[model samples]
Target: MSFARNFIGLGGLLSLAAQAQGAYTIQDTYDATNFFDGFEFFNYPDPTLGFVQYVDAVTANATGLAGYANDGIYLGVDYETQNPAAGRASVRLVSKQSYTRGLIITDIAHMPAPVCGSWPAFWTVGPNWPHSGEIDIIEGVNLQDSTSVTLHTASGCSFSQDSWSPQDCGTPGDGSQGCGASTDNTQTFGAGFNEIGGGVYALQWTSDALRVFFFPRGSVPADIDAGNPDPSTWGNPTASFSGGNCDIDSNFANHQIIFDTTFCGVWAGRVFGDDPTCAAKATSCEEYVGNNPADFQDVYWLVNYVKVFGEDGGFKRSIAKPFNA
Candidate 1:
């Protein structure tokens, strides 16, 4: 991959943090030499211990699926729980903080998306109910052509269709549980995102609004190119998940990052089965994997890395390893 250099001033940094950061320059590249000397996977204060479980029985006992270069963790899904025709694969992560400024960028390098029944997602959630909040930056089920983004906040936070996209996107209520409940049409997000090498879904947050951006592999912004936290250069972007409309930011403080692969259960399983159009093509969850068993060999997400970046003016930025020095 070729590299480039970009400049990010204070305004550009704040804009990119709220919108899309600048293109990734070579300086942001992730080198194996500088792994996790200073970084720590966030462990949220919420009661839940964040982890990725497999639908297959055998692998689930192994804890996290696999690690690429020992950087980010992998998550697998079982055959029995997977409904391929439904086009839903399960993945979830919970933040460690109650309410601090943070960003999660996942390098989803090698993953299985070409097959059927692959539903992958990158998102966040709060401690309590809808009052806390849930942000789904990339979510799609059952043969979807594009990806979808949503925010689930109580009455406090909501979203608005900025000048970027003319669509009348509504800020979902707490009951819908944000994107978890909002059944958005999958085909609208474009074909590139659902394809191979997948893409990067960034969930940027603060006490204000939560925004999301999806970057295909080669096109990941320059600010994140070096693979550390630098939310200064990304440019103005059309796709975003703002929490300002509904008061969504207050419920979450210390957020944890979760990466898991789940099979058919509630969303991808039951919901697709009920859809009139997709039901005809949907087969029994059993027929999908035979006994690959959630206990054994299942689907997994091979992540390149999981990075955390702070917002424009909220928290202090700390670096574990200096790529340039």
Candidate 2:
């Protein structure tokens, strides 16, 4: 059902799976020239839409997305004095409609989780938050090496993770209402998140479950290319999201993927200097600052591409290759 074409061990491999029902193809590929068009805005500071600013920072597009080095879109944030909340920023896509059932796939070059006050995430939220469940597919805190996937709901919702690594923790509300942590190698998720090519993240949502999966650079199949994709064959959805947990499926309509690098504040900031664990490091949260101010204008996130696929009735989503080919 799939094949690979090796070109001097340099070019990426390609894999194709025979369609179980209808034809499948690539729906959209966010390249450098067109990547900015799909996103409404980047790195703008506004709390209403969840944007935070710092004094020192740097952000730019990396080349991995464009198949060239340092040429794709990237957003980096570095703060020296710490802000209200981690110097956070976010953007929205599909503002009018909520996509309850679809496949959201992206080639992310990096989602940094490097410092004590660093909180990096790729997640989705409904029109209004809290009431409409929030699905955090990839998230991590300071010193966390593995990514944490959690859902925030009002009630009548429970989650179970069937991952290769031992899953841990469960609390409720705003992530502080007794939430727990999963026992996975947090660094495995961050170690090479940006350096060794980056990783591919896929979030599949259906009436029955919300699933997530991560594919490392060399491990991804060739057929999952921007030119063509077959969701059924990209490996199981990373996480199986369920609907029995408070109509979360309905709450996540018209959601968007967000990439943010927030600094010490509220959640992560509180842990600094006060938390015994942090004090033991002999490095106060302030020690992380290395001449760079809160808004240094040097940090950023590089995204390869973001692709969305609307399910066509069954367990499959068919994407047609654009004629631009």
Candidate 3:
């Protein structure tokens, strides 16, 4: 309960048109006063089949599961039960509005611990999914050393990055292991991320490629902290996905931001037994996660704010009392 809350209704719209000039203007800001106003809770079943009980915003707020925490937006889960039938209680959120091409940056204060059976992600996806494209800005499964930036697209899409693997951004079920890259910086995600008080994760979507950048808490760029992000001056990106044979524009459109944490899903569950440390915990991913509720107390996201910049940005018109007169 050490957080602030505001009941102010959502107001205004900001121009977020993309420009080729590389200069971006402030389009929108989702901070403590308006974080929940900007994004909506996703109570739908887990698409990745993770052991999770996604709850509505009403339930979230009422149950102390999602709310403000220490000046940041905190999304947490249930850790008191010893194997509930409905799965671990958690929260999933998606932006109310969608975007096509632009700069999305978020300042996070804490992320879920990189413990066994835990999967957390902050990403964006096109309205049509694979047909449009999916960008994994911050994502990793169970005990991963670091998060990975991946781009999943329809058939015939791939990128050129030094450390990326498989070189195939194919659609789902193509036997291709996704096209993405990861860094050795453990501080970029999980336990290491929370140690330094989290950091900033930014994604730039353009007609040619989708790129991701990470700036640890103290190393954040002056331009970004100033609300004027210039990726050009931010140096080389952490990961960049430029399509070789794919039409980036036609393949990706109207993307909505997302944040979620699931347990023992497709990735985490499938590889559970393969990990020596995790495997030693239990016979299966479900067994470990279901029995150990106390281990997940640190499973949460505390975000300071999320900002969007565009070629020509302007603030949304604020309204008061609905002006029925």
The CA lDDT at 225 in model 2 is 62
TM-score of each: 0.59, 0.66, 0.88
What local lDDT score does residue 211 receive in model 1, on the 0 to 100 scale?
54
For model 2, state the Cα shift of residue 232 in Å: 3.0
Against the unseen true structure, what C-alpha lDDT does each candidate score?
0.42, 0.49, 0.78
> Which candidate achieves the best TM-score against the true structure?
3
lDDT of 2 by residue, 85-140 (tens): 44333222221123455677777665664555555677765545554556677776
**What is the Cα-based TM-score of model 1?**
0.59
lDDT of 3 at 289: 88
Report the C-alpha lDDT of model 1 over 17-81, residue by residue, as the tens digit.
Answer: 32333332111222122222222232222122111232222233233332223333444443353
Best by lDDT: 3
lDDT of 3 by residue, 1-325 (tens): 1235432333324333433434776666787777777677888778888888998888888777788767678888888889978889999888766777878999999888877899999987765457767888998988997888877777777665444555667734542256778799898999899888889999887777677899998999998887778998988888877636768887777777788899998888999888999999999998998999999988888888888776554212222111110
Candidate 3 clashing pairs? 12-316, 13-316
Q: Weakest 10 consecutive residues, lDDT, candidate 3? A: 316-325
